[model samples]
Target chain A: MTNLPQNEANDPFVDFSDVALRYGDENGTLALSGVDLSIKKGQFAAIVGPSGCGKSSFMKLATGLCPATEGSIRVAGAPVTGPLKITGMAFQNPTLLPWRDTLRNVMLPLEIVQPHRSRLRAEYAKYVAQAKTILATVGLAGFEDKHPWMLSGGMQQRVSLCRSLIHEPQLLMLDEPFAALDAFTREELWSVLQDLWLEKQFTCILVTHDLREAAYLADVIFVMSARPGRVISTHRVDIPRPRTIESTFDPAFVEIVQKIRAEIAQVRKESKAPARPAAQEQVQ
Target chain B: MKAKHRKLAEKLAPWVVIAGLFTIWQAAIFIFNPRPFILPSPALVYQSFIDYRDPIMAHALFTLTNTLIGFGLGILVGAMLGIFIGSSRLIYAGFYPLLIGINSVPKAAVVPLLVIWLGIGQPPAIATAFLLSFFPIAVNVAAGLATVEPELEDVLRSLGASKLDVLTKVSLPRSLPYFFASLKVAVTLAFVGAVISETLASNDGIGYLMLQAASQFRTSLMFAGLLVIAAMGIGTYLICAFIEVRMTGWATRKQTQVTGGG
Candidate 1:
C-alpha cells in the first residue's frame, strides 16, 4: 500500500495505463484499447484522429463519464472512481443554458462544484465578480446579461469556454470546442483559448479532427489510430509562446501537421478492410 | 413597431368577432321571433343578467373558488409526481401505466364516487376538478423533464452535481414552458369538472342555477348563467396566460418571429 501511494505521487497529472473501454455488455465492441498516456501538470495536449476512432470515448474515460472496462486511469494522482470534481469540459455545440444569460451560465459550475457551492449563496457577489472576469477574458465582457440566443455562435462558444473554466478546475477537457464555428471565428477562439491557458495554466486535453487546431493550440499532440483507438504517435510542438495565426503557416507547423495526417491516413488504410462489415451492419 | 401593432390588432380581433356574433344573434331572434323557452333573445338574456346579478355573481364566485383550489392542489400533487416519475426510468415505467388507466376513467364517473365519499358540496366539486386537471400537468411535467438535452445533463453531472441538484437547477427550469402550456389545457378541463359536479350533486354554482332555471322555464336565466360561466372561464384563462408569459418570456422571445397572425 505504501509503494502504491508513492507510485501515484510520482505519476503525471493525468495518467492512463493499458486502458481499454468496451461499450455496453461484456461482449460489446471495444472502442479503445492499449492506451497508455500521461500529461505533466499544466501542459496542453491535443488528441487528433480520424472520425469513428474513439477520440470522444477517451475524453469520456478521462472525465469518468464512462468507466473503463479494463486497466487503471489516474488524474491529479487520484484514481478516477466516478465523475471527477476537479475537471471542466466544453463541447463543439457550445451548450450554454438557453434560459440563463451569459454571466449566470458562466457561474453554473460554481453552483455544482464545492467548496464554492456551499459558499455561493453567502458569497454571491464574489463569485459573480469571478465569472465576469472570466467572461471578460474570453471577450464576452459586455454581453454578460444577454441570453444565449441573442449572441452569435462564436460569442456563445466563448461563454461556454468561460463556463467551463469558472470553477478553475485542475484539468480542462474540450471535445472539438471550435469545430462548429467558421474558420475566422475558430482561429480567433484558438488564440482566446491559448491566452486563457497561458494565464490559468490548467492541464488541457482537446480532442479534434482539425490538424491545424491541434498544431496551433497544443504543446504536445497525440495522433490516434483508427478504432479500437490507441495513441499511435506523439509530436511535440516546440514553438515559442504567443504564437499567432501567422505562425500557423511556419514550415515547422506545416511539417508537423502533414506528418500527423500521413500517420492517420496509414491507420485508415490498415483499418479499412475490417471496418466495411461494421459499416454495413450500421447501415442495416 | 410593426409587431407591436400586430399584437394589438390580434387582441382587438376577438372582441370584434364577439360583437358581430351578438349582432347576428339579435337579428335572427328579431326575424324569427322564437318562443323564449326555445331560444331567448340577447335582450331578454341581458334582462335576466340584470335581474339575477347577485345570484349569478355568487354562483360564479363559488365555482371559480372551487376551480382555483382544485387547480392549485392538482398542480402541487401533479408536479411532485411528475418530478419523481420523470427523473428515474424505473419509476416512470412503474407509474405511467397506472396514471394512464386513472386518466382514462371518465371524471364524471369519479364525481359520483367523490360525492359518495365526501358528500354533495364543494368537496366533490373540488375533487372532480382535481381529477380532471391533474393528468395534463403530470404528463406535461414528465415530458418536459424527459426532453432535457443530454448535453446539458452531462455538463451538470460531470460537475459532480447530485441528481437532486440537476433536477432543481436545470430540469425544473427547462420544464417551465411545458408546465405553463399544460396549465392552459388544465384550467379549461378544471371548469368542466367543476360544472359537472355542480350540476349533479351541488346546490350552488352556475351549473346548479342553470339546472334550476331550466326546471322553472326561465330559459333566459339559464342562458345568462352560461354567459357568466363563459366570461369566468375567459377571465381565468387570461390570468394563466399572463403568468405563463411572465415566467417563460425567454422561450417566447426566441419563437416570437414564428407567432405572426396572433
Candidate 2:
C-alpha cells in the first residue's frame, strides 16, 4: 500500500495480453478477441459496452472462472490457470442462499476460502464481529437474522456486497451489481461501493451498462466493442475522491459520461446493422 | 390470534371431513338395508375394531414395521442414486430414462415378480414398498440438484469452492425441501405397495387380515383393517410433514405466510 500509484507504473496487478475467448471448439462463437487490458494495483476499473459484448467474458477470463482460448491472463503477477483464491465476485442477482440468514450469507465465502475456512470455527466470534462490521458499513447491521427473501432488492444487493468483501480478497469482480436496482437505489449503492473501494483500495473490475456508473466509480473506464468484444477506448476519470451524487452533475463527470455513452451508442448501432459491413475493421 | 384460530381450524378440518364421511356412510347403510357383507356401517366397523383390536394391532404393527424398513431402504438407495445422477450430466442423461421406465411399471404388477424371485412373504412386501417409494424420492432429489441456479454455482466456484463444498453447502441443503416433499408422497405410496404385496402373498399384516376377513365374509373386519391402514398412512404423512416443516421451513415460509418486517 506504499504509494501504489508510483510503484505500480511498471508492474500491473491484472494484465491481459492479446486475450481471446472462443466458446466451444474450433469454428465456434468467439466471445472475445484481441482484448488487452492492464490495471495497476488498487485501481478501480470499469468496463461499459452494449448488450451481447464480452464484458462478462473478460471478468471470467481475468478471474480464471473460464479459460481463455488464446492469450495470457495474469492477476497479481501469477498466471491464472483456474479460479483464483484472491478474487471475490458479485453478480447482478444477489444470489444469496435463501436458507442462510444475512449474517451467514455474508460469511459464506469464509466457509470456502482459507485460511478463514480452517480458522473460522475456532475464531467464530471474531469472524462474526468482522461480518457485522462489514454489514454495518453496507447499512445492514440490524437485519443480520433476516433471510434473503425478507429483504428488498436493494438491501439484498447490500448483503451481496458485504459477502463479497467479507473474505478481503485482493481483486473484486462486479458484473452489473446494481443494474437491477431502481435509479435512486443504484445511485446510493454506487456511493456505498465507492466508499468501500476508497477504504480498502483493492483492485476492482466493474462491468456495467450504465455510463454514469462507470464514470462515477472507475479510475479508468474501458469501453468495449460488440461481440468478440475488445477494449475500444479507455478514459481516466480525474474527478476528486469521495464523489457524491451531486458531483455527478459536474461538467467533468457529465462530459465523461456523455463521451462514453456516445461510444456505446455507436457500438450498438454497428452491431445491429450487420455481422460484417466493412473489411476495413476500423479501431477507434 | 388469527394465526392460532387458523391453526386450530387446520387441525380440526380433517376430523370434521372424516366425521361427515362416516355420517354419509351410516345414512347409506340405513337407506339401503343391504347385507352386512356388502357394506358395513361405521358403527359396525367400530364394533369390529373393538372386538378384533388385539389381532388388528398385531397385523398393523407388522405392516408398519415392513413399511418403515422398506421406506428407510428407499431413502438410502434413492438418495444415493439421486445424488449420483444429479451431480453429473452424463449420469443423469444415461439413467433418467431407465428410472422412468422402471417407475412406470406399477409396483402392484412388480410385486408378483418380486414374490417369484424372493418367495411369498415379508421380503416381497418390503421389496415392493422400496420399489414404489424410491422412484419419487430419486426423481425429486435429482430435480433439486439439477435446478441449482447457475449463478449461485458461479458465485461459489469463483470463491474457489471445490465441487464437494458446493454440493455440501449449497446443493444438499437446497435439495432438502424437495426430499421432504417427496417423502410425504413416497410414504403413502410405500403403504400401497406393502399392502398390495401382502394381499397377494403374506402370512401376516393388515392386508392379509383384510383378505381373510373378505373370504370369511366378515366385511366389518375388513373395513376395520381399512381404517387401520388409513390411520397409519395419515400418521406417517403427518410425521413426514412435521419433519419437513422443521427441517426446511424456510422454503415454505412464504406459503406459511410469515409477516416479517425485514
Candidate 3:
C-alpha cells in the first residue's frame, strides 16, 4: 500500500485492467470492454474515438460515476466505489450557475466537498481568493462578480474551466469541454489548460472526438471501438512538452492523428454493419 | 440617448392611459349629477379614505396580515413540496395529479366546508388563502426545479458532490430564480384567497366591512372599504414585486428560469 501510493505518484495514478461496462438488465450492449489503461500522475491524457464509442463510459468509470461490471479499476491506490473527492470536471458548454456570479459559481464545489465544505464559512475569503486566482489563470479576473448571463460564451466557458480547477483537485476530467467553443477560443483554452496542468502537475483525463485536440493535448491517446467499445489501440504521444498551436502543424503530431483517424474509421465501419442501437444518445 | 428616450416612452405610456381613464370618470361623475350616496365618484374613493381613515386602515391591516401570513406559508410549503415532487419521479407520480385535481376545484366552493371543519374563523380563512395561493407556487416551482440543466448537475457530481449537495448547491440555487417568479404569481393568489374569504365569511376584515356598507346602503363607506381592499391587494402585490426585484437581481437574466425546457 505504501509503495502503491508512491508508485502511483511516480508512475501513474489510475489503472484499469480489463474493465467492462454495460447499461441495463436486458444484457444490452456493452459500453466498454477489455479496457486496460493507465493515466500517469500529472499527465494530460485524452481519449479520442469515433462517436458511439465508450469515451464517455471511460470518463464515468474514472470518476466513479459508474462502476465496471467486470475487472479491476483503481485510482490513487484505491478502488473507486463512488465518485472520488479529489477530482473536478468541466463539460462542453459553459454551464455556469445562472443564479450565481462567476466567482460564486467557481466556489460551488468547495462549498460542497468535504474539508473545504466544513470550513467554507471560516475560509470563505481564502476560497474566494483561490477562485479569483483560478479565474485569473483562465483570464476571467475582473468578470468574477458578474453573473453568468452577462458574460459571452467564451467567458462563461472560462468560468466553467475555473470552476473545475478552483478546488485544485488531483485529477481533472474534461468531457468534450471545448467542443462548443469556436476554433479560436478552443485553441486559447487549450493553452490555458496546458499552463494549468503544467503548473499544478495534476493528473488529467480528457474525452474528445477532435483528433487535433487529442494530438495537441494528450501525453497518451487511447482509441476505442465504436459500439461494444473496446480499446482498439493506445498511442503514446512522443511530442515534446509546452506545445502551442504551431505544434499541431508538426509532422509527428499529424502522423499520429492520421493513424488514430484510420482506426476510428475502421471502428465506425464495423459499428454500422452490426445491429441497430435502439437509443442513439443514451445520456452519458 | 435615442435608446433611453424609447425606454422612457415605454414606461410612460401606461400611466398616461390610466390618468386618461380617471379623468374621463371624473368628467362623467360631474356631468351626471352625482350625489354623496349615488355615484360618489373617484373622489369618494379618495375622500372616503379621509373620512373613515382609522377603521378602514385597521380592517386593511387585518386582511393584509391574513393574506401575507397564509401567502408566506403556502409558498414556503408548496415550494418545498414542489421541489420534492420535481426531483423524484415516485413523489411526482403519486402526488402531482392530486395537486392538479385540488387546484382545479374552485377554492370558494370549499370555504363553508373549511369553516365547518375549522370553525368559522381565522383558521378557515387562512386555509382558504393557502388553497388559492399554493397552486401557482407549487406548479411554477416544480416546473422551474425540473428544468435544471443536466450538464450543470453532471459538473457538480463530477466534483464529488453528493446528491443533496447537487440539490442544494446546483438544483436548489438554480431553482431560486424560478421560485421567485412563481412567488410573484403566488402573492397575488394569496391576496385573492384572503379577500375572497373575508368577503364571504369574515366580520373584521376590509372585505367584511365592504359587505356591511353595501347592506346598510352606505355607498361612501362601501367605496371606502373597496378602496382599502384594492389598496391591500395592490400593496401586497407590490411587496411581492419588490421582493422579487430585491431577491432576484440575478434571476431576470435567466430566461431558463421561466417555465420551459433548459
Candidate 4:
C-alpha cells in the first residue's frame, strides 16, 4: 500500500463529518446525531460518555459495521459501505464459539481473513507459534486449549483481546470490553493493552463508560452528551507512557476524570429538565 | 487395563440383573401353570431360539439394512434442510409451519399409501422409516443452528466473511450437537417404523417371522422371534450411541462423550 502524504492524512484513520446514527427506516426514532470527529492516524482515542450516548453506535460507524443514516463516514480514506476487514473489534461479551478450543479460537481469524486465509493450513505452524507468543504476552500461556466456559472471566477476556489483535489490523475498536471484569483485572488489562499499543501504533477508538479508563488509556478522550449524543468536551491526556495505578491517583489525571464526570452529570441534568419555554414574542 | 476392567465390571452388572429377571420370569410362568402348548417353558423357548437363529439372523440383516439406509437419508436431508431454514428468516417463516403440520399428521396411516405407490417391500418400509424420523432431527437441528451465538457472527462479519462462509463455518458446526441429540430419538422411531411395516406384510423379516410363528401356533418360536426383535432394537440403539459418543466427545464440557447432548 502506497503511503499517503501528511497533508492527505489530516484525518487518515477515521473521519465522521456531521454523522447521524438512527435506528429503523424513515419516520423511525433517532439514535444520535451531529457527531463530528476526526481521529488522526496512530492515535489512542477513547469515546467516554453515559451508557445511552451512542458511543457504541459511533464505533459501528467508524468500522463500517453499521452505516450512518444521514452523514458521511470515511475510514482509512475510503467510504465504508459494509463491514471493513482492516478494523478489528472486541465487544462487551467475549463471544467465543463453544465448539472450538482456546488455541483454535485465537487462530480463527487467520483461518478466515485473506491473504492469510488463503494459506492458513500451509502456514499454520508459524501462525500457532505467533499465537502462543501473543498468548504468553497476555499471561494466558498454559490455558490455550481449554474451553471458554472452563476459564475465569478475566482469562476469557484476555483470550478475547488476543482474538481481536490476532490479525493486527490498522484500527482496533473496543466497546466496553472490560466492563464485566473486576477492578484489579480491569487495571491489569489496561497495562497489557497499553503495552500492546506502545508496540503497535494502530489507531484505536475505545468506547467506554469508565472515565478513569478513558483518562488512563487514551491520548485523546472525547466526552459525548446524553442521547442525540454530541461531543461536548475533548481532553488530551498529557500523561507519560507505561503509566500505572499510581498515575491514576496523580492530581492531573484525577482532575481530568472529575471534569469528564461533571460534564456527563451536567448533560444528564439538562436531559431530565422540562421542555424549554418559548422565547417571549419580541419586537424585531 | 483399568478401562478394560471397568468394561468387564460394567458388563457383569447387567448380566447379573438379567439373570435375576430371568429367574423371576421363569417363576411367574410356573405360577400360572399353563399347558406346554399355550405357554412353553423357558427351556423350550431357548431351544426354539437356537433352532430359528439362522433365519432370524437373515431377517435381522434385512431389517437392519432398510432401517439404516432410511435413517441415514432422513438425517442427511433433515440436517441440510434444517440448516437452510435456520440460516434464512424467509425460509424459516415459510417452512417452519409446514414442517410442524407435516409432523403432526398420522405417519402410520400413510404406510399403506406409501406401499401402494412404492410396492409393499423394502421400498415402502424404508420410505416409512424416513417419514417417521426426519422431522425431529430437522426441528432440533434448526433450533440449534438458530441459537448459534450472534457474537461469533459479529466476529466473522468483522473479518470479511462471506455469507456462505458464516453459514458453513459458524452456523453449521454450531448445530452438530443439536443434530446428534435429535438423532437418538430418530433412530428408535425409525426402527419402530421398519418393524411395524414389516409386520403389516413382508416375505421374510424378523417381523414376518413373528407373524408366521403366531399363525402356526408355535408360541415358543414366536417368543424367540420377539426376543430377536428386541435385540435388534437394543443393538441399533447402541450403535447410534457409540457414533454420537465418538463424534461429539470433544464438543462437550463433560469429557465423557457418551452422555452428551443426546
Which candidate has the top score in lDDT? 2
What 10-residue stretch in candidate 3 chain B is worst by lDDT?
B253-262
| DockQ-based class of model 1 | medium
Candidate 3 chain A lowest-lDDT run of ten: A275-284
Q: Name the DockQ score for candidate 2.
A: 0.85
Residue-level lDDT tens digits of model 4 in B1-262: 7766776787699779878977887897889888766888777889998987898889878877878888988998888788878878889999999998988877678777887888886987788778888888899888987887776787788889898888878888788878887888898888777877787757767777778888999989887877776777777778877777667655664646322334
TM-score of each: 0.92, 0.94, 0.86, 0.88
Prediction RMSDs, each to the true structure: 4.4, 2.5, 5.1, 4.5
Alpha-carbon local distance difference test for all models: 0.89, 0.91, 0.80, 0.82
TM-score of chain B of each: 0.93, 0.95, 0.86, 0.85
Look at candidate 4 and give me any clashing residue pairs: none
Mind giving the per-residue lDDT tens digits that candidate 3 earns over A197-252?
88887888999989999888888888877767766678888788899999999999
Candidate 4 has an lDDT of: 0.82
Q: Is candidate 1 or candidate 4 better by lDDT?
A: 1
Q: Please identify model 3 stretches exceeding 4 Å from their true place.
A: A1-12, A27-29, A119-125, A274-284, B23-58, B213-227, B254-262
Contacts from the true interface found in each model, as a fraction, amount to 0.68, 0.91, 0.80, 0.66
Chain A TM value for model 2: 0.94
Per residue, candidate 1 scores C-alpha lDDT tens digits across A85-175 of: 8889999998888889989999999999989989999999999999988888888878989999889999999999999999988889999
Candidate rank order under DockQ: 2, 1, 3, 4
